[model samples]
Target: MRIRVDDLSGEATRSLIAHHLADMRATSPEESCHALDVDALREPAVTFWSAWDGDDLAGIAALKDLGAARGELKSMRVADAHRGRGVGRALLHHVMGAARARGLSTLWLETGTPPAFLAARRLYADEGFTECGPFGDYVNDPFSVFMMRLL
Candidate 1:
């Protein structure tokens, strides 16, 4: 699979990102969903990446600089057809590498607390991310599950 930093300008990448945001909105209340839209993910501090297999889009993920030696992982999503096929893991590993390449000493992420996110939480845990309090501009919210790892 080819994983490249994306500018969110391609039709396929944008559609997949929109799908990810829509799912996040559907799973969590508006105030609690922290998933970024394509345009938001394109901010100067953020680096978005899309994974592809030949001509097909497999997944997408992003990393946002949070100042200090910190970075935040954002918008990780594997296509429904690509779920459980190591897409999320591969995308996450790629993001972590990017974070390290940028000299980040810590990486954090915010995910939902619902049962729909159990597998996601497990994935983070398996990657050595421990549960943590809200970082950055995030507040304390029971619906939010925050995780972080030192690079």
Candidate 2:
């Protein structure tokens, strides 16, 4: 598998991001879901990447600079066909490495609290992420689970 910075104009990357947003909306209804679409991923503070296995887009991940030596993980998703294949883990590791390279001392993320998100929670936990209070523009929302990791 190969993971690299995404241009957001590629069809495979766009489809992956669209699917991720749809899943977020389907899983969390109490809060307004606001995931970056392909166009939105092009923001200056955001860095997006796509993980590919040969020609297939296996997964994608993004990180947004939140200032003050902090960063937020956004739009992490593995293709349905790539689930359980370690694509998510690889993408996560890549993103964390990038964050560290950017001098971010802390990496944070918010995910849904649903059965569909259990694997994601477990992955974060295994990667040394601990539950944390809401950060950045986020507030305490019942539907969201916040996590943070020190780099």
Q: Whose TM-score is greatest here?
A: 1
lDDT of 1 at 29: 92
Single out the weakest 10-residue window by summed lDDT for candidate 2.
Answer: 30-39
Cα lDDT of model 2 by residue, 36-146, tens digit: 787778999999999999999999999999999999999999999999999999999999999999999999999888798899999999999999998888888888899
Please provide TM-scores, in order, for all candidate models, with all chains considered together: 0.97, 0.96
Model 2 alpha-carbon miss at residue 125, Å: 0.3
* Model 1, span 1-151: residue lDDT tens: 9999888999999899888888888988999989998779979999999999889999999999999989999999888888898989999999999999999999999999999899899999999999999899999998999999999
Count of backbone clashes for each model? 0, 0
Residue 84 error, candidate 2, Å:
0.5
Clash pairs, model 1 backbone = none
